[model samples]
Target: MHDTEALQAKFFWFSPGDMTDVRQFFAPGRVNLIGEHIDYNGGHVFPAALTRGVSLWVRPRADGVVRFFSVDFPETIEARVDELEFRPSDGYANYTKGVIKAVQEEAGTLFCGGDFFYMSNLANGAGLSSSAAVEVVTAAAVRALMAYPLDNARIAVLSQRAENDFVGVNCGIMDQFAVAMGKAGHAIFLDCQTLAYEWVPVTLGDYALVITNTNERRGLADSKYNERRSECEAALRRIQEILPDIQNLTQISIDRWDDVETHLASEPNLLRRARHVVFEEHRTNEAVRVLKAGRLAAFGQLMNDSHVSLRDDYEVTGPALDALAEAAWSFSGCLGSRMTGAGFGGCTVSLVRRAAIPEFEEHVRVAYADKTGLQPSFYVSEIGDGVHEQQKEGLEV
Candidate 1:
């Protein structure tokens, strides 16, 4: 948990302001439990928000100058509300500037700038959606500052727009939505096609969700993420000729794909990409059903299956992710393990028995280090709430 007093003191150190008009906001990073590489395919995704995420302290400025500071970086970035644009050199601050521009455009009105101080416990490039957390938290603070009449769901949509339009990453809505509207002790079952969702209770009786980072440092924009998306699109276009009503790859059932697979035999790569989407979509839906029924073993099996499809069919998981996941799978206490996120290199989430967490960690740690020659980081995940104000007593903006 984050220390409010400590964060407030750091905020004062950075901004040199009294606590009179400062409002604090928090947005959690998310872990996709069973869904991998399927959100863009218009499939159902199962994701839960983690306790680790980004927190921001905002003090509205009288002028239009917005100053951004982070505990993770040395330099404070400054921008004008009227001139928010993406700059490659700006690094992480681009997410903040992107959200500010998105809010101004979506709300159809300009808002005052603010001094934004950020602090986060989330590991960047760990497949924990840190960028999404930053975007959502910024949107929440800007909404509070400008009194925008948008709900949490709308906040998610606009944040996604920031990433897609401003940040130039063609990510789906799962990351932003999971971070913006997550409920504690529950995994959201969301349909990417229709955006219909429901909260499913995560009842892991004696099991824990452990996230292991490969420390390979893969960037989403520079990685093969966009290439996989393009391949899926190409497959969808070819399949559309056979079934014109079909919208996305996930819309095709496994049996339906068996009937249509012969048509795409000429393009082997496209076949594999589409195969992953269709089958992975089925696995995700079944995982949700078994999880709701407390069939944890079945849910774990589905997680393992999701990883295989992601590895063989989608061709996303690299050597580091594969080594970590395979090591976890060899442990007897681990119920399931799979590579999560966009996955050229990132993290693997494993469901392990609570009593065996120590052994599980050591086993995987030694094995992964031996195979990859790099140390991996581990975090025991705690499900948490979405973006909201951290209210301070007797303080109002």
Candidate 2:
């Protein structure tokens, strides 16, 4: 449970002299352990929901007016349930507004106004799925407030819809699914094509999943994400000329790759993209194997390989990202390090021994600062559960 006293103090600071009852809802941010850009290419993604994320203290209003306040933003927002439209000026609240519109489509008769006071420790635009966290939390809040019929998976789907149609970011289901279905101490092995998944126990015997944000903020909708996906699609189309049975880049094997090697060699860019997607899928499969076999070292090596492919072949890592991951490689305790997420510039997930985390952090901080002239931040992430509601009166999920 979160500290109730601190929450009450913060809540009072925002809305003083108010005695409205509220419920807290929380959704966890996520980190992709391996398997980067291939999520939409019909590949597998290994991700775990993190402990840090967005939280909301929401209470219904009889006036049917929606109001939003956040410690992170300067201004408070007010609107009607009927006027929930996307306004670029609204910033983070757009995710909330998007969710309201999405859920309203499902439960049209249950539209009601509410006040939402939000705060989060998650670093926005740092490749931690903060937007998805906000949308999922908002979806849960709406469901709880109206007593609507929706499960976490249903909420995740609607949240993805909000991002795609409402928020205008064409993100895949991995972020939403992991944030909605996450189980503590486990990483979800998800087939992006089929949406079939399983929880793999994350038994990192002596190492921890450390996140180092390069602080080079990136917005996915504005990044090269769509272009990268299109490249993979184009590559898939080219390969299908030779292997008529192939559906996605994932189905093309290393042998099949050899068969069509010359065809792809003519188009180096398409070849590189297809190679990364194919190898990344294999790496994800291998990663699951190593994790299940209790082999952390091998798992760490796959992380290294994944980053190399993303860097050299995929070409998504800018100088900031390259510096961060390269610096992590020099750290004593770090077994492996890779740039995670859409990865124009964001964070790197590193596997480091628990005892050496402080040294690891200081080393990367100094090295990254010296290289980029911008200081970076580090967080030792914990795998946590998906979105859940905190009952009335400060109960924890």
Candidate 3:
């Protein structure tokens, strides 16, 4: 845990003035445990919030000017609440600006603007939802300052809107939702189709959840993410010609895929994309069952399957991710390992025996660096709670 008093002092250092009205807020980064690349397809996603994320310290301004400073970034950005627009050059501050605009559209004009100072432990481009974390934290700060009457779920939806419409990333709701509504020590079983969700206990028993970062940065906005989404949409259009009742790729059951396969056989890429969505949905459902039944090994196997489908079918996992996952899989201490997040580049989630964590880390680190020539970073994280205001005695807002 970070020292609240120290963070407050840092905020004063940045602002260089009175700190009386400053308030603190936090939102967590998320890691998808199994389901990958299927959230947009209206399939289930199992994600949990990590202990590491973004933290913000804010002091509201009455002049409608918002100022942002980040310890991790090089410059301080300033903007007006009414003139917020997408500026690719602004970098991380764009998330804050987007959230302010989203809140204004949701609830009339804000009563005030604020100075935001951000500190994050999450690695950039590691696929840990750092962007979503910034958006949610900014939303939480605005809601608290303006008393905007928005709940956590609503906050999540608006944060997603900021990403999709304001930030120009065609992301689904899973990242924002998981970051906004997560509970400590559990994973969220979410149906992307209906937004229905349940919290399942993360009972690893003798195993720990280890995240291995390949250290290869992913530029999702410029990457093939949108192309994949377009491919899936095309596939759905084709399937509707026959099964008009199906709304998404996941709605077509795996048992019925063979029949549907004939319809998509001619379009090889679309067929592969649709196949990954359908089978991944099936794996996610069974993973939940095995997870709840205390079948740890079975759940691990499903994680491995999810990675293979993402690599071969979805074509998202690149060499760095593949090397890390393959190295972890070779270790005897690991029950299962797979690439998580948007793939191409990022981290892998592995279930490693608690007793062998040291050996597991060393073995994978050496093998992965040998193959990819990039040193990998590892984190053994516990599930953590969602976004909220930090309560200090006499300082609670």
Ranking by lDDT: 3, 1, 2
lDDT over C-alpha atoms for residue 374 of model 1: 91
Q: What stretches of model 1 exceed 4 Å from their correct place?
A: 1-10, 219-221, 393-397
Question: Candidate 3 residues 1-397, lDDT tens each?
Answer: 4466776666677676665788889999999998888899999999999989998888889899999998778788999888998888999888889989999999977648888999889998899999999999999999999987999989999999998888888999999999999999999999987889999999999999999998997865246889999999999999999999999898998778988799989999999999999999999999999999999999989999989999999999989999998998899989899998888888999999999999999999899889989999999979999998887443221
How far out, in Å, is residue 41 in model 1? 1.4
For candidate 2, which ten residues in a row score worst on lDDT? Answer: 388-397
Q: Write candidate 1's Cα lDDT for 95-154 as tens digits.
A: 999999989998898879999988888887788899999999999999999998889998
Clashes of 3: 0
Higher lDDT: candidate 2 or 3? 3
The residue-by-residue lDDT of candidate 2 on 175-241, one tens digit each, is 9988988999999999988888999999998899999998886754355888888898899899999
Q: C-alpha displacement of 317 in model 2, angstroms?
A: 1.1
Better model by TM-score: candidate 1 vs candidate 2: 1
Cα displacement (Å) at residue 27, model 3:
0.6
| Candidate lDDT values, in order | 0.89, 0.87, 0.90
